[model samples]
Target: MLIAQVTDIHLGFDPDNPAEFNRKRLDQVLRHLNEIRPRPDMLLVTGDIVDRGDAESYRRLSVALGQVNFPVWPCLGNHDQRENFAKWFPEIPFVDGFCQYEVEAGPLRLLVLDTLDEGRHGGAFCEVRAAWLNARLAEQTDRPTVIVMHHPPVEVGIEWMNTDPAEPWVDVFRQCIKGKSQIISVICGHLHRAITCQWEGTTIAICPSTAPQVALDLTPIDAEAPDNRSMIIADPPAFALHWWNGSQLVTHFDNADEHVMLAKFDKGMQPLVRSLMKERPGAE
Candidate 1:
């Protein structure tokens, strides 16, 4: 199964504007996905669909997402308002103050977790959310499962971007994921950059933002001090593709504007091309 992951759109940020930078970036992503040779089975918008918790923001978000041909599953981020998100996406099921849902595609089971602790930059699962996650994990022990959330459960070595007050909630999240061999990978967003980590014996991947990217700075500095330092890069919108090959999950980061097919095929590539043609049948 192929899943396209886009995150941190921050739509409706400019309420009065006809075109917002973030919304344009999102459109580019959608157009790129639609133009792909083989489209993804589903699209996962990790979170931060809107910058503020406003009704108009949610409405704009709904309209933007409506352009996609594939199914989209969204989670809430810190900047998101749960009530507004619910108002926009009434089809999604929420339980115990979490927007949690389960999707079964072939042999893969995707578990979407809501870690948005409204009005905060970090995240929390709480006791109820943990119990719900545990129950979900238990129910699908035999199936290969992938967990998707807005905030990553593990710190990615960047001190400032690390989860603030990362004590109790991080520990709780860790304990819930431990000893779960069936969880092939954990996908997340919210840092606004692409990152990977290992926590509780599972692979954790953080997708890049569809808007401007966060600059990669590992230095510890004052959070409030305006040192003329920023972690945002004005680069093209990016996303991640998670491929479930029935046994393991492999993730590839795609920069849509930077894709180029190199013409460097070697003699050894002929056999592989023949094999692919045989498998595809119709390919010449």
Candidate 2:
């Protein structure tokens, strides 16, 4: 099974206009996905779908995602408004104010977790949500499962960004995932940069954003300095392709410009031409 993951779209950020930097970046990502030789089985948008908690943003997101041909699953991020999201995406499954859902693709099970805390940068899974996760894990203890969330459970080394107050929620998540050999990986995307770490014997992968990337700075910035110190670089948009072959999950980071070709080539002379090029002008 092939699954494509795109995150941190930040749509509807510019309310008065249709064209915004983040929206255009999202369009690029969608275009890349649409042109793939073989489309993925499903597309997962981890979170940060909008910059602000507004109904209009959610409406725009719904319309934009309508272009996708495969199944699209979304989870709430810190910038998202749950009520607005639910109103626009009424088809999405949610329980006890948490957008947690399970889907079975062949022999693999996907567990989507909601860690949004409404008006904060970090995330948390409350008691109700934790119980839901535990119950789901117990029910499918025999099947290979992959947990998807917005905020990563482990720290990403960047000291300031690591100040998320969701540290308390890690224990609950650990308790549920520990001793579960069936779990293949924990996939997340909040830190706008590709990051990976190990937690409870499971691999945690934080995907890069499809928009402008966050600058990889470890310094603690001065509070008096303007918010400009936060991010940097307008990187090319990208996404992750996860291949589940029943036993192990292999991931490939795909960029829109991944394809490059040699203009001129002869099938039989290719190796001879390369060997000739390596030889000296008069020593061949």
Candidate 3:
């Protein structure tokens, strides 16, 4: 099973201009996904699908996503407006008036969670959403599952972008699936950078955004600290691919930009490749 992710598209960043930068970035990534061999079995667009959460933006989102050949699943992000989003994605399932659902794909049970706390910039796993998740996890015990969401529960060290670990909702979310060993990983977005770590005994992976990315800064910053540094970068658009090779799940990050190929497996490199490959411990 293969799962690809693109996030924080923020379409309509330039509401009046059709030639918006984010739109181009999204198109580049979509074009790349369409051309990949054995393309992803499913694509996960993990939140902030548009900027204002308006009807027009969602309409544009639908049109762009219509070109994708694989099954595309989207979850709610902080910037998303439930009512407006529902107008375009009326087919999306809702539980307790929140965007939440489950999907099964090739031995993987994906539990898509809704962490959107409308009118706020951070995330929340409120009581209602958490209850729905608890039920979903209880439904299937033996299946390998993955949790998909927008804002990652863990702090990624970007001060302004980080969610406090002590938040009440964060603790409540942890209690729901703390010891559920069936969960293989938690795939998320919103940070706009590729980050991987272990939390609650499962791998937590954050996919990079299709639009500009959050600058990587690990230093401590407080309210009194200076704030003149750049926050967003014009780096190449990227996505994450989760590959399940039977026993375990592995993730890979890739950018959509095309760069000149400086090397290839031509005749000169063939012998070296053969020699290295044959030397593997599992080689027969």
**Among all candidates shown, the one with the greatest TM-score:** 3
**Between the candidate structures 1 and 3, which one is better when assessed by lDDT?**
3
RMSD to the true structure for each prediction, in A, is: 3.6, 5.8, 1.3
Per-residue lDDT of candidate 3, residues 1-284 (tens digit): 88889999999889899899999999999999998987899999999999988989999999999999999999989888999999999998998899999988888999999999898898898888888999989988899999999988898899889989998888988998899999999999999999999999999999999999999988777778777787899999999999999988899998998878998999989999999999999986
Best by lDDT: 3
- Give the least accurate 10-residue stretch of model 3, judged by summed lDDT: 219-228
TM-score of each: 0.90, 0.88, 0.97
lDDT of 1 by residue, 194-274 (tens): 888777889989999998888887777786876777767897899999888767889999876855767546787888877
Instruction: Give lDDT tens digits, candidate 2, residues 83-177.
Output: 99999999999988789999777778999999998777888877899899889999978888999999888877676667343587877777889
Q: Mark the regions of model 2 whose C-alpha exceeds 4 Å error after superposition.
A: 163-166, 220-230, 257-284
Candidate 3 lDDT:
0.92
Comparing candidate 1 with candidate 2, which one achieves the higher lDDT? 1
Please tell me which model should have the higher TM-score, number 1 or number 3: 3
**What order do you get sorting by lDDT, best first?**
3, 1, 2
lDDT of each: 0.86, 0.84, 0.92
